[model samples]
Target: MECPNDHILLSSGLKGEEKSYIFRPRFNYSKCTKCSLCRDNCTENAIVMFKEGYPFLMPTLCSGCKTCQLACPSKAIEEDRKEIGLTYVTPVNNNLTLVTGVLKEGEERSYPLVLNTKRRADIMDFDLEIYDTSAGTGNHVAAALEDSEFALVVTEPTPLGIHDMKMIMHLLEKLNIKGYVILNRADLVNDEHIIPDYEIIGSIPLSDDIVQSYVRGKPVVDAFPESDASVELRRIMERVSELLW
Candidate 1:
């Protein structure tokens, strides 16, 4: 019943051997007809035959991939909501809105919240839609970036940055989305050949003004209009506008 990511309770006796899993499956009693398909198809055998002949889930063994729900023709399985994250929408300006999804600390599942946030944004008619994805190419990030027209991958000129940048570039190509790179802190180390395949739309050098703008709780463009960083951002905006409009 214990998977690699599971936290198993290493106690003696049958009752004390239960494990606590991050992803737990909830069975719907009213919708289930004791088809036994869920049990038979589950290679993990997480669903066991109950005394009532209905399906009982050993939550510990469940991988939480929702495969059992797909197997059930009646659609009897429902994933229990764990309140893993919260989405917030705030007005940025008359024309722009900011939607932020905050994942609960120590939570593994964040993609649902990302999807919810995107759905909220999609329902509203807007002139432009920007999906600011999180770092790394996890399912959560994919959920946010999926179907996006363009992904602005911001990275520094370093070995680690180049490595992760290449990974996301490949991911974008796999998703059939055009990607652009904004070399952040370009002054740190300039290597134009690092991500040679992806287009470099704009570059922002390391600057005290850029740091100060962030510290002052404002966008660099709004805080330092004539700063080099702000200029690069404006150039990026113009490019985006040309492509989209």
Candidate 2:
């Protein structure tokens, strides 16, 4: 996996800091001897020599390890920093906090941002931390869920959803992380669907109130306490509490 580096800075925002950084190679042509040492030593093959006898970097392929800089015999390579993402800590309420990682637009790499976000959250004082990972089985997702005591594998009743859910479950098994399934939008399918070798903790039917809560930028439990989704979610939480505690 390609990774650069990270640094946390105190932002003007409330109760937290922002971290965003990536290192790239900058060539000092005046000092370059065109020996191709930097290109030769690059493990990622990010450097290429022009017909004019100079090296250029493909930023996307570079791992930003500074290997080229260190290997340059003529001291031509220099360090360049770019902000790739932002990590934010927001006060959700008196008892809750939210830490989010956002990658810059057009940035392809997300593993470093995920790592920095997790590091930021790990430093805060808390009794429990609920990590909400993006929908995928990529390395970024693995990094986010690594070291978690257990995971709630949320999935829908659609065919694509079930297929992807199984892939995620396989990943969790390989990571030695225990997992339980939560069937979301369970009313969409009438057939009896069951996940083998994993317990189903809850079944939540699709509800309009849940959609409204999403539109209003609030949690369903807070926005619609009496809604069916909210009730089912509370039961799921109780089950998880019993399993963990």
Candidate 3:
């Protein structure tokens, strides 16, 4: 994951004091000896030095582009990759393999980690894989959707849900991936216009069983196989399999 100019290496994640490979200006300034190696080797000339000879970073001018960091022999430049979090693979009770990417608190670049998790999942053999994506239609969501054969976009029945669903639908269309909408709190709003064209794969009511299962770190499908939510989830998975395979 080295950036082209060799200034930055794509970090796997931070471990204890070890930082990720992305360039963090704050850390760079603190560690730099002002040897001007970064300035001399900078391809984009994005680095600006003060009269005191300290480097000033203009991230807007920066393409996230790593050129200056590579030229610096001091190795002062670093990134917050560890802050992004790591991808974990765990085996659940029903032989379901759970691949999860937990973002570090206050970390901004969540999608890259999600992308990494998905890539890891691709290499492992499993009967079924489920991605519980972060809320919102952003880069993280987009990256998660990239390799997914099918997507279950869960939403509530409200103006906000419809608005977000439309955005996600547009994204899915752009990616040429088909998805089904699952109304989580179906009692809140009307279904008349929510997902008129697409199939309503399944619905989960706002119920205590769902909440209790989630609190106990259990999938509703596995926790209560006979429950309505569990039955619907299985049906949705079946439909998704047909669409994908």
- Best lDDT among the predictions, by candidate number: 2
Per-residue lDDT of 184 in model 1: 93
The candidate, 1 or 3, that scores higher on lDDT is 1
Per-residue accuracy of model 3 over 1-245 as CA lDDT, tens digit each: 11111111111222222122234444466678988766666666767877668887665344344566666778788753234455555543356555555555555666566666677778887756666666677887788777667787888888888888888888988888888888887777755665556768888777677777766556666567888777877887787778767
Better of 1 and 3 by TM-score: 1
- Measured over all alpha carbons after superposition, the RMSD of each candidate to the real structure, in angstroms, is 10.9, 5.2, 8.7
Computed on alpha carbons, the lDDT of every model, listed in order, comes to 0.71, 0.81, 0.65
Best by TM-score: 2
- TM-score, one value per model: 0.73, 0.86, 0.68
Model 2 off-target regions past 4 Å?
1-19, 41-44, 73-75
* Clashes (N, CA, C under 3 Å) per candidate: 0, 0, 3
Per-residue C-alpha lDDT of model 2 across residues 38-130, encoded as one tens digit per residue: 999999999999766889999889877798999988888888977788887877657877777778887887888888888888999677888
Residue 84 CA displacement from its true place in model 3, Å = 2.9
lDDT of 3 at 45: 70
